[model samples]
Target: MLNLAPELAERGIAINAIAPGGTATDMAAEHTASYTPPALRDVPPEPVIQSMNALGRLAEPDEIATVTAFLLSSDASYITGATIDAAGGWI
Candidate 1:
């Protein structure tokens, strides 16, 4: 994305990336159930997962999509060659 953004910007194109952290989704639920670390194995998933981020909770799907929408909209016309951290302050 970094390499292509500059070249694409010359043609009036905007390119960016969204790096989302843990989100409360079906896929996340399944992954957590199967892959939780041993230290957190016995603990309840909600609190343990929420505590992984500074925001104390996972992000909503729309929250991440909103950032993508903005980048695609004229509101972010000046934004390019960047990665938006939509991670809810994941640690």
Candidate 2:
């Protein structure tokens, strides 16, 4: 995105990305149950999350959606060539 942003900006286009940390999604739920090690999987997500990020919990889908909305809105017109960290202050 950083590379293409300047060129896209010439056409009045914006390119950005979101780096989201752990979140409660179907994919995550499924993966956590099957893929995560048994020891870690059985341990409630709260402590694990606390170790990974400040929020200490998974993000709701709407939390991510709100960031998307803001980026797409006119309020963010000046933002480009950037990655928004919608990770609830994950380190």
Candidate 3:
């Protein structure tokens, strides 16, 4: 992703990657707690997701989108290869 960034920059373009730490994707639910699966079970999905995060909150999918917007914005003109960790601080 970094290499392409420079090439794309030739045209005054910017590039970045968004790494969502841990989210409750259906694919991730296949595994159980033994795998430390990201999704929560019967414990009420809302807050349990929060406790798993370092910030004590779960990240709604759109939250990541917001960060992506910022990175693609002129405000981040000097930024590249940056990662928007929109997992609500999940580790």
Candidate 4:
């Protein structure tokens, strides 16, 4: 995106990306149910996974989508060649 954004901007096209972390999706639930670390073998994975971010919770799909919508909207007219972090403050 970084490389293409500049060239695309010349044609009035915007290119950007969103890095979402720990979203509360079906895939996330499946992965949490199946994976367990050696040290945390006996521990439940949900809390451990949630603790990976500063918010202590997974983001809803709409939360990430909101960011995406903004980037594609006129509100973000000046934004380009950038990656928005919609990670719930993941560490």
Best-fitting candidate, scored by lDDT: 2
- Full-model lDDT for every candidate: 0.86, 0.88, 0.69, 0.87
Backbone-clash count (model 3): 1
Worst 10 residues of 4 by lDDT: 32-41
Error of 3 at 46 (Å): 5.9
Error of 3 at 60 (Å): 2.2
Q: Model 3 segments beyond 4 Å from truth?
A: 22-41, 45-51
Off-target runs (Cα >4 Å) in candidate 4 are 37-46
RMSD versus native structure for model 2: 1.3
Name the lDDT of candidate 2. 0.88
How well is each residue in 11-64 modelled by candidate 2, as lDDT tens digits? 999999999888889998988788788777667777777888887788999899
Taking the tens digit of each residue's C-alpha lDDT, what string does model 4 give over 1-91? 7999999999999999999998889997778667856676677756876779888888999999899899989999999999999887898
**Model 4, residue 56: displacement in angstroms?**
0.8
For model 3 the local lDDT of residue 3 reads 86
Strongest candidate by TM-score: 2
Tell me the RMSD of model 3 versus the true structure.
Answer: 4.4
For residue 57, give model 4's deviation from the true position in Å: 0.5
Residues 1-91, candidate 3, lDDT per residue (tens digit)? 8888888888888878887856555565554454654453445555755667787754556777778788978889998756666766665
lDDT value, residue 72 of candidate 4: 85
Q: Is 2 or 4 the stronger prediction by TM-score? A: 2
Clashing pairs in 4: none
Clashing pairs in 2: none
